[model samples]
Target: MTDQSTPLAPRQRISPVSRVAEIVTSSPVVLIASIILLVVVLTALFAPWLVPHDPVRLTPSVRLKPPSETYWLGTDAYGRDLFSRILMGGRVSLVVGVAAAIFAVFFGLILGLFAGYIRWIDAVLMRMVDGLMAIPSILLAIAIVSLWGATIWTVLIAITIPEVPRVVRLVRSLVLSAREEPYVEAAIAAGSSTALIMRRHLVPNTIAPLIIQGTYICASAILTEAILSFLGAGINPSTPSWGNIMAEGRIYFQINPGIVLWPGLVVSVAILSINLLGDAVRDALDPRMAKRGIER
Candidate 1:
């Protein structure tokens, strides 16, 4: 006979704070990177209100002034407040990066969906993707910007086109494998339309990978924009961008290294933070990686 006084065990629950602490301890690098990214993003988003002076407003007498109570990061050769311009430039860099990534991912998703789902078009589209990939992306971007003229929109387009092929290949491969799954085949046997099968079965599988891809694309796009602008082929020089700021500072670098130093640091930190976040996300989303971690 069973003992009359046998007690049932209570279920243990993990609290949100404990879960957060576990994540932070398990991936301290990602936690630090996330904090850095958050601070940068917030500063850029509120730059207009947070800026001490107009980024573009100039004072001839104050040109090239060193850091002071009045001029925090000093004045550029153009006499604009270096601190304010840096803040504003962050806005431009982030905007271009995010916009280019979105354009690339959106077009890539559509083209990949069609190419992978429609067997007849796959060969032609994949070949086109291959040809694009063969060319050095920076050179291709330069050629496009040269023809289109160096405006903000053109820079965004140039950055996006080069990135699309990478996304297309990833999405296409995912769709190809996913479409052959037993569930997908069963859906086909049920007389489901191609659209329904792709929408319901394939697209959902692509989201996690696409999100990680998007972060990398954003980091690359930002770096590309800086390179193009430094080469005088990106957004107009009049605009306050990290690239433009660094480009201008090169001439007066010996006199005021701070000008180049500040903006360059901003770009470096932003890219690093983004890449770290992407790596962390990839580890979290990839089941194989999680399995390996557990095994270790």
Candidate 2:
């Protein structure tokens, strides 16, 4: 008679979003990475509206002017608006980075799947990957750019060529492991085609590593593009790039250190953020590690 209608115990409520909140709150590196990425994205999205002056248009009299009311980030030697150009240049930086990563990963996955799945292709793929591993990526990129002529396409292709083999090796290793799983074996026993098993079982399982690698490749691509531009082997001098900005700044470091400061700072922050993002992804994707991290 005490509480026939009501339960003896009080019901406990749990929120689904609590887990997401816990993750964001506990992971300082991830939170910082997210913020850094957010800053870049916001800057890119508002570049056209945010810049006070035309990036490409020049004012001869105002060339090399210091930071002031007229130009927040100061003028380059060309008298073009520094703030505008930096923001606009981000578009190119991001484009080259992302495009190169995609190109490399696409080719990598195809090669990796064939290499991992087909016995005949395995030796050839491994040998090619090994050959690529012997050469430093920067040197390879430099050689390719030298031959293709210094243009955006050439730079992108150069970046792609070096990254593909590394990605293929990583993916091939993953696929080889995945092929041994019960689901894969079941598919094989059920008479599923190799292509179907790969598509349905192997590729999906390899997604996590692939995603982490893609981000790393993107960061690397940016660095590569910057190096190429700095050395006068990348995008046309007429165009603005983070690297070109820094390259030009090196000459004026004595007169106006701000030339090197702004672009260099941007590059460092960008690369750091990308690394942080990679760490976050690696942590998140590994369940055992995530749980251990959360506990710690």
Candidate 3:
């Protein structure tokens, strides 16, 4: 007979959604950062409806006006609404950042799987990856933009290329470690196809790290896009990107400091929030971190 006095251990929660929620709410910094990121992303996504005026519409009459009831963030040298431009500029930055991250991660995952599982191709692929990593990302992006012209597509391509090598390195390392695991070895012994083994046994191991890396890549891509625009090698001047906005505002900074300060502030806040969220994700996904927390 079982001992009546002995109580059963509480069941551990295994739901993925609940786990994600617990991780998100465990830290106040993560919660706040997630909220801020959400707001910024939503605002950017609906910029067309939220903007009170045409971001690119020029008006010479009310140029350099300070923040007021008529202009929430004030008017630029061209008399365009600063608030409108900021909102619209966010769309461009977010799009480039997100798209670049997705593209980099997608391509990187494929290349990394092949290189990690197929030993014959590893050396050749890694050599190419190393060569790309040797160049400074910004300079490489600049060169690409210069060659292709400063369109949104070119800028996206430029940012994605520099970021791919980093993701490839990350995924490759994860796959290398995972491929040696018992499950992977068993799969190989069972005559599973190379793709099947990678997809079923190795890919799952890389998901958490890839998620954290993607957030960082998104932040970096945003900053790089801004820098490219500032240097006149990003999107078209007529387009209102955060970088272009600040670049235009620099010439008249003495007249209206808001022009540069506002966009710069937004960019800084967005990047900070993304980075903090990434950190939170990293902590949540790391078993060592959870063990330390439990010990504490």
Candidate 4:
């Protein structure tokens, strides 16, 4: 007979691989999305070596040629290999999306920490964030790109600027709640420096939410870059980004729909996978959702 007051042994923490395996096995959608995203990312990363023909090489003889054994996907207006171009284009899209998300989160975390922890700067910082948020993100990005010129870096900056405000707001809200907790108050009373308290006490509370937010931001950034490229406000047309591919093919859609369809399909799948992964992460992280046994 066990003593009534005796505490049970603590459960061991699950390994990250085990946790991921559990998530994948429990959800078929998550499994499929994860596989597709993994394949796309790997294909993009290895594209330079994997491509059979030069993505930008112009073979006028093969221009507008339908899918063949030589050109697996087909040829575009300039006879660039659609398959090679797509693989290379994905690298650009992934780079921009990932870099933009990282920058946005990094800058937003710093600003939000300052704004939420220091009351003196809270109103001022929030006002600036509000001003940025007031403008439409797409319009703001276009304006920035137009002024700066259409380069990969310029497009990344354009996408990142609009996204920072949202992240700042999210972090600020998280900090606001966390700072009021008893542990935070105890830290404050213990003569800890503002920076120390923020780093030790506040930052951890924001990590889970930030991870979930980052996935959405990455997806949005990818879509936004594609839109910008399509509108001639993004990467140089010479560069074979997914957006440029679709934009070039739009005029020839009636003749060769595959050019546009292929890139568009890839973009849709990438974004959908990212979003679905984000949802899975959210469900896994949220204690309330876990307690409720929510499955999606």
- Give a tens-digit lDDT track for model 1, residues 109-162: 988988888988898999999999999999999999999999999999999999
lDDT of 2 by residue, 1-296 (tens): 57669657853432323543455557897788778877986887688898788888868898888999889888888888887888877878888988988898899998999999888899887998999989998899889989889888999999999999988998899989988889889999999998899889988877878878999999999888888888888888778888888787788787777877898788778888887877767666766765665566
Candidate 4, RMSD to the unseen true structure = 2.3
Across 1-296, the per-residue lDDT of candidate 4 in tens digits comes to: 97779788885655434555677678999999999999999999999999999999999988998999999999999999999999999999999989988999999999999999999899899999999999999999999999999988899999999999999999999999999999999999999999899999999999888988999999999999999988878899999899999999999999999999999999999999999888888876776665454333
Better of 1 and 4 by TM-score: 4
Q: Which residue runs does candidate 3 get wrong by more than 4 Å?
A: 1-11, 14-17, 292-296
Task: Give the least accurate 10-residue stretch of model 3, judged by summed lDDT.
Answer: 11-20
Q: Residue 245's C-alpha lDDT in candidate 1?
A: 96
The residue pairs found clashing in candidate 4 are: none
Per-residue alpha-carbon lDDT of model 3 for 72-92, expressed as tens digits? 999999999999999999999
Q: How close is candidate 4 to the true structure, as a TM-score?
A: 0.95
Q: Considering only N, C-alpha and C atoms within 3 Å, which residue pairs clash in candidate 2?
A: none
RMSD (CA, Å), candidate 1 to true, equals: 3.4
Q: In angstroms, give how far residue 239 of model 4 lies from its true place.
A: 0.9
> Cα deviation of 182 in candidate 2 (Å)?
2.7
Candidate 1 off by > 4 Å: 1-25, 291-296
Per-model TM-score versus the true fold: 0.91, 0.89, 0.94, 0.95
